[model samples]
Target: MTQNLGGILLIRMTSLGDIILTLPAIRAIRQHFPLHRVTMLTSLEYIDLVSEIPYLDEIITLDRRGKEPAETIRVVRQLRQKKFDLVIDLHGKFRTRLLSGLSGGRQRIGSRRDIYPPNTHAIDDHFQLLSTIGIQANDKSLEFYVTEANQCFAQELLNEKLLLGDQVKVGIFPGARWDYKCWPADRFAEVADRIGKQYNAAILLFGGPAEADLVSQVRDSMQADPILFDTNLQIGQLAALISFCDQFVSNDTGPTHIAVALGIPTIVLFGATNHLKFGPLDPMHTVIRHGNSLDRSKGNDMMRLITTDEVWKIAEGKLNSLDK
Candidate 1:
């Protein structure tokens, strides 16, 4: 079959949560143009996870967190060589703008100007780059692709940790990249304790290496018949592990999105972010937001304010529904 477009380069190069959220739009694009070669520009750490997505023809990984200007230049040069037919700046940052300018694509699609104050829901502001091209984005729902390898890994991990005939596995994502998005680790431990004791479920602490400390803290704080699965694994492995859980409770982070996409009952704790805009869309998912709507600051200020009981109730409700 002939394709309308030669090739497309989509740039979304930051934040685990935001990158995961773009999958729905990516799926839409593939459905809209089946013959187009849809490539992605993302961080090196996420290469394994993104590669599992069948829609992506190729993935160009970069180390965007590096501060050196030469690093950006290196990626820009590589992008220029690809000579893509179109460049879509989904990230909409200044660096992405510069890269798109140098991409040598015939058409560059980007957002309108955004001058919002800091601490706003960055997702909406990023989409402003689409104004000039008349591409209006109404939804921010996330989608992910999990392979059978992931499922088998999850089961193996669970079986290794749990005795036969006791298949109760629960997931707890205890870390957030942004300080403001993280609830207190103790609160998570409290929830884990309750879930473990009441349901006889084993808690799996989920996060990358950066979260090992926080995960350890939560595991240590647990008081009620504590049994936890804490591992420093790759994102694909983490996703696989989460697939084995009966339910997942996490802060506003990437792994939570992955759990929801896998059709696992997930509870997302939202503190500094706006729930109206960035909440998960799955029927089995629950989002607990702070009562205050105008407090848009980042860090633990808002996250720390969420009461333990509030999260506990939401989590229990989801668990009950999932069990039924």
Candidate 2:
């Protein structure tokens, strides 16, 4: 197959976790087409996060917030002007597929659910899409690049909070997009307390603006005072702050994927979602699912089934390994 020298445009818009999962495939694409201009089209909100990634030649953002229809047409026009040889839609949603079809690329590729089953891990699903173009992806590892400025910002924030030290730092993200996806706030507080007392670790609670109330609830419930980080941080800044942690604990949320990408030993609690499909595949991370079966109908009840002791045990093991 002859490789096209013309530009390549990749589309993946919205959701932090899904965007993060696409890194491995993007890296593979970059490796295969080193000379070709590789551009990524993602959501405007994730510009900071995507900018940190070193894989692509350029990044295009679409703000599909209030006026999605008008915004989509404007983006489609912009994409047409780019005159890409190949367009790959990493996000297989209706909007992304429409963008790929209308982007005026000579060749466009979208998700191949037939090649890779729905049960397959998201990272592998992305690789399956690349297979259609004869691009064999060997490295399935996720990557998240942290900038020096973000690192300095993280350090300064920690210093201000008196959290800069060699002491073990455990980052806890207690909020998820959906309530059913989140483990109980009190349970998280209990686990954080145990980790803090047992390891004398600094507990850092992280969340977005929307999760501020939930984060505060967890902090209030905790026996120990934790550093609150719900100040609407950009994704890159959040990644830098997470990098400072020795261990990360979270519900089935986007930041869990961020921690995994950063190679931080993470313990993620899963319920109502299939752990095999969405959970971290890295050996360094541990996934604690609610039960053997996935019953979304049960709602957050499934999340509640995962006891504090169950998660604490796994967290303790990972922290112990880190100590060694």
lDDT on C-alpha atoms for all candidate structures: 0.73, 0.88
TM-score of each: 0.85, 0.96
Query: 1-324, model 2: which lDDT tens digit per residue?
Result: 357559999999978998998999999998898889999999998898888788888998999679778888898899999999999999888878888999999999898555667578988898878888889997988888999999999999899989758889999999888888888999999999999999999999998769989998998999999988855998888999999999999988899999999999999888888777788998889988757556667758888888999889998888888753
lDDT of 1 at 120: 42
Per residue, candidate 1 scores C-alpha lDDT tens digits across 1-324 of: 224467888988776667776666666566656788888988887887888978789999887566568877788888888888878877777877877898888788864335544444445555454444444555655556667786677677667765444556788888877767888989999988888877777777766667778877887898854445555676777887777678889888888878877778888888866665567765668887756554556446767767888878877776776543
- Which residue ranges in model 2 land beyond 4 Å of their true spot? 112-115, 292-295
Q: Candidate 1 at 107: error in angstroms?
A: 0.4
Best by lDDT: 2
Which run of 10 residues does model 1 get worst, by summed lDDT? 111-120
The per-residue C-alpha lDDT of model 2 at residue 23 equals 91
Q: List the residue pairs that clash in candidate 2.
A: none
